[model samples]
Target: DTAVSQTPKYLVTQMGNDKSIKCEQNLGHDTMYWYKQDSKKFLKIMFSYNNKELIINETVPNRFSPKSPDKAHLNLHINSLELGDSAVYFCASSLFGENYGYTFGSGTRLTVV
Candidate 1:
């Protein structure tokens, strides 16, 4: 069983287009997260959800939204894609607490032309 999965592992599009990436985890984790990994490989948390409650990272743009239909799934929606948005999107999940490190998906590469 896949612990975590995200669709469209590679997405190429022109600027100003909107797109959505889907994520699902079968680990029965209570919390799920969306993280962006830039070309330089710096990973940053964008959003997190636990039991359907949204937790926003202050640095994330308002143009990025996260939707969690259930504890097992969280999806990322991006509006008006920009070249700056070209990066790998990773989906992760972990239990709540200090010691929890996330289990990340391979990642979805979003390239804006």
Candidate 2:
């Protein structure tokens, strides 16, 4: 079974369009995070959640948001998307510890035209 999975593996939208990516992890991990990979392939942390509580925001823009309905689900919602929002969004889950590595989803490719 897939440990972590995200919906809409590929997304193509126009500027100003709103979209959302759904993520779920069956690993029973309490901690989940959302990361964005830009065209330059630089990964940046967007948000982190621990058991439905927001833990880190990473200074992400107000247009982007992360919502965790439960320990196993963390979803990303983007509003008023811009051209600069085109990138790969990845969802990962891990135990709340440094030593425990994360299990990431395949990633959602968001292309804002």
Candidate 3:
């Protein structure tokens, strides 16, 4: 089984549409994160959740939200998608306190046209 998995790996939608991407990890990690990669391939962390609590939210736009219903799942939601929102979104998980390295899910490509 995949250690990490994300649903709807590819999404193409019009501007102003609202969408959500789901991510789940099977590795018993205590921390999970959502990252965004722009066209320039610049990877920036959007949010991090540890043990189902929000933490490490980098100055991400208010339109973006990270929801963690549980420790193993962290989902991302974007409202009023803009053309700039088009990018690859990655979900990753890591074991707290050990720096074991994060296991990343295959990224979801979002294109807003």
List where candidate 1 sits over 4 angstroms from the true fold.
Answer: none
Evaluate candidate 3 by giving its C-alpha RMSD to the native, one decimal.
0.9
Which scores greater on lDDT, model 1 or model 2?
2
TM-score of each: 0.95, 0.98, 0.97
lDDT of 3 by residue, 83-110 (tens): 9999999999999866589999999999
Question: How does model 3 score by TM-score?
Answer: 0.97
Cα lDDT of model 2 by residue, 13-82, tens digit: 9999999999999998999999999988899999999999999999888999889999999999999999
Give one digit per residue, the lDDT tens place, for model 1 in 8-112. 999999999999999999988899989889988898888889888986565877889899989999999999989999999999999977798889988999999
Global lDDT of each candidate: 0.91, 0.95, 0.95
**Count of steric clashes across candidates, in order:** 0, 0, 0
Question: What value of lDDT does candidate 2 attain over all alpha carbons?
Answer: 0.95
Give the residue spans of candidate 3 off by over 4 A.
Answer: none
lDDT score for residue 113 of model 1: 99
